[model samples]
Target: MAQHEDMQEIKKRRDAVLSALVDGVPYHRFLGIGFDRRGDELTGVLNFEQKLIGNPFLPAIHGGVTAAFLEVTSIITLSWNYLWQDMEAGAIDLGALEAGTLPRLPKTIDFTVDYLRSGRPRDAYARAEVIRSGRRYASVRVEAWQDHRDKLFAQATGHFLMPPPVTEAKAGKPG
Candidate 1:
């Protein structure tokens, strides 16, 4: 019974984290980005639509869309890492997350993308790896793939300014 309750608690935390990622940012919803979380790993999903096409000639996904996907993936992955720290310490407020008052996501310092090939007009998936994370900064690498994960359509490296942790006092809780 104790183990079952523990599993339920973990599931709740995971759901809250995903909600913060998908619903906290408006653009993420507008762009049709979805996430799949398996333990600590995440994959960003871009649901294809006709409106996302750049050139009807090549019928490729827009460069801007691809770039946005990579950037979003990196940012969310880094944010997840930060949130996990609080989760491990049992310091996260699930109510705040559910209320959409999540801690600020990291701000992008620089993002560089390499378009290996045109994104085909279909669903695209991306996975980000937080290469380095520190108190004040983080670095992430992302790869977007279409049909094959090994055959990437584009890849990116991003640096971000990590936000300071929010404390109970700052969050308007009695400290």
Candidate 2:
């Protein structure tokens, strides 16, 4: 079925995007967050390790690190959603999109993070859902949880403005 092929394409794209985003971050570098794509949802896991430590007393993972994980995962999920749209519309080449080369980060018009619990110094998981996907904007909700625990450490909602296609910009460039 065509839908099966589309799912394969999406998985490939998600892997590429995840690798690109996790490359330069220090915490993500050490914590080793793993990206898994399931249809429209993305789930990332971070294992507790020395690098995530803030203080030995509480051994709490830094809040900033938690936020970063949530943000990046959410953005990538949003990007994947957009890619799916492109595929459905038959508007762009999937190969170019997979090369870390197409569409840029959409401007983040609004974001709100709510802390539900403290970041544990152990395993943590983040899952995101796309609330709305429009031509130029998307809304996503992300939740971070301590591994093997039902409590959430943090939850965030992000609104991003998808940028115009790179090809469109090139077409407008002065010759």
Candidate 3:
């Protein structure tokens, strides 16, 4: 029973993170991106719109849009990893995360995107994998796919400077 309750708490935490991802970031919402999360895994989804097409002749998704999608995936994945540690340590204020007030997202140091193929004008998906996450820095690799996972349209690697860990004081809670 205790294990089940722990699982419930974890799910609640994850859901709050997801909410912050969707509601806290205006650009993410503007781009119509959503995420599919399973445990620590996250896959970004970009629902297609006519505005996403850059070239009407080819009707391909915009290059800028693809890069933004990949970057957002990387940042959110890294932020989630960082916050999960705080949650496990019992140092995180769930209310702060829920409010997205902590602004705990890592800052991008550099990001490089490789366009493998022109993105088809349709819904696209992306998944980010963490290469390394340390105390102050993190690296992530992300791939975007349109129809199939194996057939990637674009991929990117990013380095970020992580934010300071959230403590009770930082979260505006009594320490």
Q: In terms of TM-score, which candidate is strongest?
A: 1
Full-model lDDT for every candidate: 0.88, 0.71, 0.85
Decoy 3 TM-score against native: 0.87
Question: lDDT by residue for model 1 over 1-175, one digit each (tens)?
Answer: 9999998988878878777768788998888998888888889999999989998999999999999999998988888888887776678777877788777789999999999999998999999999999988998999999999899999999999988776633677565
Provide the lDDT at 17 for model 3.
67
Stretches > 4 Å off in candidate 1:
168-175
lDDT of 2: 0.71
Worst 10 residues of 2 by lDDT: 18-27
How big is the positional error of residue 97 in model 3, measured in Å on the Cα after superposition? 3.0
Alpha-carbon RMSD, each predicted model: 2.2, 4.0, 2.7
Residue 36 of model 1 has an lDDT of 86
Q: Give the candidates in order of TM-score, highest first.
A: 1, 3, 2
Q: Per-residue lDDT tens digits of candidate 2, residues 101-168? A: 55565567877889887787787888888898787788889988875446788999999888666466
Clashing pairs in 3: none
Can you give the TM-score per candidate against the true fold? 0.92, 0.72, 0.87
Q: After superposition, which runs of candidate 2 have C-alpha atoms over 4 Å from their true positions? A: 1-31, 87-102, 165-175
Candidate 2 total steric clashes: 0
